[model samples]
Target chain A: MSGAHLLVRVGETTAALPAAAVRRVVRSLRLHPLPGAGEGLLGLAEFAGEPLAVLDLARLMGAAGVAGASPAVTVVTWIGPAGDRELVGLAVDEALEVAELDLGAAAAGAGEVLVAERPVRLVDLERLGEEA
Target chain B: MSPELVVVRRAGALWGVPAAAVAAIERGPEGVTVRLAGGRELGAEAVVGLSGEVSVRGLAPPVRRRLPPAVAGLALWNSEPVAVLGVAAAPAGGRR
Candidate 1:
């Protein structure tokens, strides 16, 4: 990891959603089905009595799951650009830790970015709304 | 306001089918199946639990489209989300 980032385990990928974009991390998101929602989208959740859309980070990354999965962690974050931002929960296998990721050191591309010692998928939180 | 609904659980989620439309609730190898008078079938992987009526609200377009046509709307039962189903298929692709 090089720059300030919040590392979360989304299936087999260790995704880094910018720390600034992360609102909060909660233990497990209880989800309801959004039957026609895209594969990456899970369903809905309530945050402070308000409806919240929960998206599966693993499904979005296209990996799906990791063996020996731990308890689920819901990362509430803002997706999309400012003025068009929305609060959405990104559910992952677990929240690893907040670390500094050095993208300049590794070869990263194709929807992935280099972090610390490995290349992890790069999630564009900004463009998420259109897909869900 | 919506009318009476027969609670049906399928594929690990709770579903609400209109009371008037249900012919019989049976248990077989496919798990709990809610057979409709119109010859439509709503099957579940888990056992069907028909409980009291639940209130339902129309789904937001984004939420409605992702689910199968069988899911009519949404309801909250026991603080859990329930997908209220309609007997007729939704307009498009509705595979689970």
Candidate 2:
């Protein structure tokens, strides 16, 4: 089956998330740190007047932490099955364009697609939500 | 005594796989190939022959404790830490 994927740069690597899962991509916003927030969570940001947890996709993928400064954009995404959706913001260094991915039926696990000749890690939002 | 380990580099990180678990090591045009016992082949930047036991002590926790499901854990190599990715975990695009 074919599906749209939003390509974004997390640190030096490129990653893709299902376009249907992404609500919107927004420029950097003021963040409010949540003390004692567990791993992968950078902080909190307000999206559409609701508090959204910001996740560090780079860190989540086992990449080194982003140095120098925070990401410039956040891709808001919906996780979990319909009727139980949760909103989350993914911090990305750059918001790349969307691409129509073949998403073959065999697609499963983490590393499953190559976009623009670079291996793109497929973010499993449902699994991530369960972890969170 | 420490266990023997096979060291390989991937995605700029050093990984240590138990030597017993490695089925074969081959060189390819793109990079070295590590064949695990389970029949999975992984591209490696460099594969160092079996080495002595590695001390797990004093290794810091991964920056993100809950790594992507594919990663097994992080371990130190030559005084630096690298992620030890799960061999059974298929690469992006399912081994394409």
Best by DockQ: 1
Q: What is the lDDT of residue A34 in candidate 2?
A: 34
- Model 2, C-alpha of A19: deviation from truth (Å): 0.5
lDDT of 1: 0.63
In candidate 1, what are the lDDT values of residues A1-132, reduced to their tens digit? 455678888666788788888888998566766545555557766654444566667765666653332327788887765565666677788888887655554334655666566766556676653454
Off by over 4 Å in 2: A81-83, A105-110, A129-132, B1-96
Model 1 TM-score relative to the real fold:
0.54
**Fnat for candidate 2 (0 to 1):** 0.03
For model 2 chain A, the run of ten residues with the poorest summed lDDT: A29-38
lDDT of each: 0.63, 0.62
CAPRI classification of candidate 2: incorrect
Clash number by candidate, in order: 16, 7
Model 2 steric clash total: 7
